[model samples]
Target chain A: MTADPRDLVVRGLTKRYANGALANDRIDLHVHAGEVFGLLGPNGAGKTTLVKQIIGLLKPSAGSITLGREDFVANPDTARALCAYLPQGALPLSSFRLQEVVELVGRIRGGDAPAVRRRVDHLIAALELDEWRDTAGIELSGGTRRLAGFLMAAVWPAALVILDEPTNDVDPLRRRLLWRLIRQLAEDGSSVLLVTHNVLEAEQSVDRLAVIDKGRIVAMGTPSSLKAGDRQSLRLQLSLVPGVDPPAPPPFAHRPIRLGQRWHLGIDQSDAPEAIRWAQDRMAAGVAEEYVLGATTIEDLYIRLIGREDALDRAS
Target chain B: MNLFTRWLRSYGLMVTWELRSLRTVLPLAFVVQTMISSGLILGLGFLMHDITATQAQFLAVGVTVVSMITLGMVMAPQLIASQKQSGAYEYLLSLPVPRTTLIAAGLTVHSLIALPGAAVALLIAWLRYDIALSVSPIVIPAALLTLTTAASIGFALAHAIPNPMVTSLVTNVLIFVILFYAPINFPADRLPVWLASVHQVLPFGHSANLMRAGLTEGLASSVGVSFAVLGGWALASWSVTAWVVGRRA
Candidate 1:
């Protein structure tokens, strides 16, 4: 079967910087139309570099990026026309009012004036930015400015929307609204590529996700599929009393990781009864504050997939 | 939309954006420029015990050239460097508008900001020194070329350098040289022969010569050579700017 014209297909994408740093190794991925695809990675994992290549800000060393029938690598103008990018940095709207910024971007992208204005109004209301509509960009808080930046891109939806760290610095309430807007865009038939390192959010939000490490894609699939390998494993998290050393790991448990006042350990389903008994005895002896045993989360899987020791060290 | 229509629309929007975004700074910029231009005309007169009509004309015309060059060479680069430091440059490049439109809009806005100062200086010279200028039609192209060339060179410098601090330092040094070291307001022959020879090949001396030709008839020698030289510099500088802006990696 032929692919839809709006699908994004990248094959053998590679980028080697002048300093001999391979920012992106040979990579392949496909994002279908109307899908919310996520690229999850830690800092410096080449997520931004890959997005830059797709949007024509950076040239690939060797790659084929096709959107529908068009070659994005060779035709950058088409890439610009077809994709809308919300960069990781703050938007350059210091002098423009929130409403004006969105309308101007839409018009510049060739949206009809009346239509652009309508969409701008809708986005402002939807994003709960009505009170700040006339406020200049510099006067707004960082999170508000970021929301306005999203409006600037969403007011004129392109074939593909690439948002890098869209939820950074956003409050929980507005973040939910932002995610809803992203879903609405996908429902309206645009592909959304979300780049972030927030593992829990990715697990809940994306239709599919790729975990990148050291310029390579370590894994890619639906959330469930990616976590399938850990289905039989249980996670035991203990909140230890202050000034108490972490307890030793049980025989069936994986290495225990101490994160400040808490310790996290993974164990098999058969070891759950013994793990809980051990936690109870420790709490009774005043060595632990509380304990909870649950299924392994994407965060745990992510740590394990990328080498837990190194990932934990970086996290700390 | 057709290509022309799309370009025209994008260009209009970009110009509006630039003007509105800079509305606050522009007023101060205009005031500073007017002060600089008028200050040079009046302040330099103190150096002459008995100024002649020819000397007054040179000073008057030279100050106007200074005003034009300052906006393009000094102000443009500084503004661009600030934008780079603030991450606006990358955001702008990611937009779908034609890259040329951005350059054109910038030049237009900066040129407009420059004009009132040049005019004010000329008026001051007329009122203070009572100097009469020929004011030939060549002044139009001469002024346009001077501004475009200077602004292009500034844009090239700002984009070519990766560090905003370095670009800012370079522009500051450039303004110092243009104001004190270069033969802009003064006749080139007043400098050492070697320096005068160097000015022949540089754009600064040629820029003043073209403006002088426009402001006073017969004041500028080799008008054709000056135009050719200024035009060449404008072309080369603009080419460099376009290349830097268009490069993707």
Candidate 2:
């Protein structure tokens, strides 16, 4: 009945279709106040479904969603009154002029005509949507319209704001501005749920994150927390000559992943003492031309965790 | 604001948004509706050798009934289905407005569209057949009830079957029933007793009967039954639509 105003708690959340395919299984997550919580997953990982349930667009087969003090599923009015959602893909309000979409959301959510106007103007200027202000959503470029959708949700600040794949297809400059804007929204005390597949950007942007795969959270923690176990492992990234095989499996608690043409071998800290020597031997053997040794990062953790799950899935 | 006021605001806002978008295509929509609604009446006039004034008046009103039914039962469902395909349906549903309010606003716009088409048909009847329509206040309420009933059914169908292709097919089938099979253009007694009994319960025959009575004095045999049947359809369809719209995908 009483919960923190700037938080979302999802517990024992499960979604199983009538055909008996489990999309999400007992997923539990706690998004804290004033922090951007990233729900990172590949396609078909139930990230969208979970967000849909949280936004009251989809009903879960089990469990409850609590955003702030209200049960979002049981009391959508309160939940929506206190929260805003930006769905994935381009803006769906393509029929409306850019400014009209902004104003509609502003007025509907905020209910203060003048204040919403001011905020709409401010966000338009900040996100540089002034030029396309009169254009319909379909007329603007992809990034411009996407920014409009984001502004629609952010035009009136709320306790909890949910954005699904907010940065997909956006240019680097606008993505940066958008990230800054998201950070500002959280700093102003909005709990931001950023669901995305861009793991690299999420690793930097999220205060805390969860890695989901095949309908379950494989990993959940801050970027630093996810990397806590990785501290024992050193990342050995190397570009090997074509037609040449990868280096012999290193004697360490390690997992090697191929990213494009390069190979990255994650070696445990105990073996960290030998990873450089090991890389040196491979380099001298002419098996590698370029090599870099660094601390294991969030991407490493994500790959390692999901890699295990995928392997088990194949076996099953 | 109170709950009623909140719902009213949401309904008005939704209609405003939909109408604003519709402004660009209003001319085309008008042409299509006008052609379809009046074409049926005009074709009857041209094809028949010696159609009487009373018969012409009945045909004009029946054709208007056909237009309103097609707009609500055929057009509304297809439009909602298209919205679902374009992802705008989900976006609209996610808004804080009440679900019924959204449907009401949509029904209002579609029903409003039906009127102009009916007007064009009435104009054709006056200019061509010299039939004078009675100024009956009941016509307004009758059209509102009839359109709302049909629109609710269409909305229910849209949510029940969200696929655009399937919905289009279904709406086409419905249009055919309203145009040829239903008693909208003729008295239920003209059909076999079994079919007439079925039409007695259905809202379409009642719809045309109500419209005919409004346009011509003392023509409807049972206005009360017609109003009751149409009201029942409205309530039943509205219930189904509200239930289906909240269902999980």
With a 3 Å backbone cut-off (N, CA, C), the pairs that clash in candidate 1 are none
Please give, for every candidate in the order listed, the TM-score of chain B alone compared with the true chain B. 0.95, 0.93
Give the per-residue lDDT digits (tens) of candidate 2, residues B88-142: 7777777777877778888888778777877887787677778777868888888
User: Tens-digit lDDT track for model 1 on B142-191?
Assistant: 99988888888888888888898998899889877777777788788888
Give the lDDT of residue A61 in candidate 1. Answer: 97
lDDT tens digits by residue: candidate 2, A168-273 = 6678888888899999999998999999877778888999998888889988988998888776678888888788877666767367877554777987766766
Model 2 misplaced stretches (Cα beyond 4 Å): A1-5, A89-91, A232-234, A237-253, A258-262, A267-295, A308-316, B246-249
In order of listing, the candidates' clash counts read 0, 1
Query: TM-score of every model?
Result: 0.93, 0.90
Clashing pairs in 2: A232-A269
RMSD each, Å: 2.7, 4.1
Q: What DockQ does candidate 1 score?
A: 0.73
Task: Please give, for residues A165-276, the per-residue lDDT of candidate 1 as tens digits.
Answer: 8887777889899899999999998999999888888788999999999899999999999988888989999899998877777777885676678778888899999999
What range of 10 consecutive residues in model 2 chain B has the weakest lDDT sum? B20-29
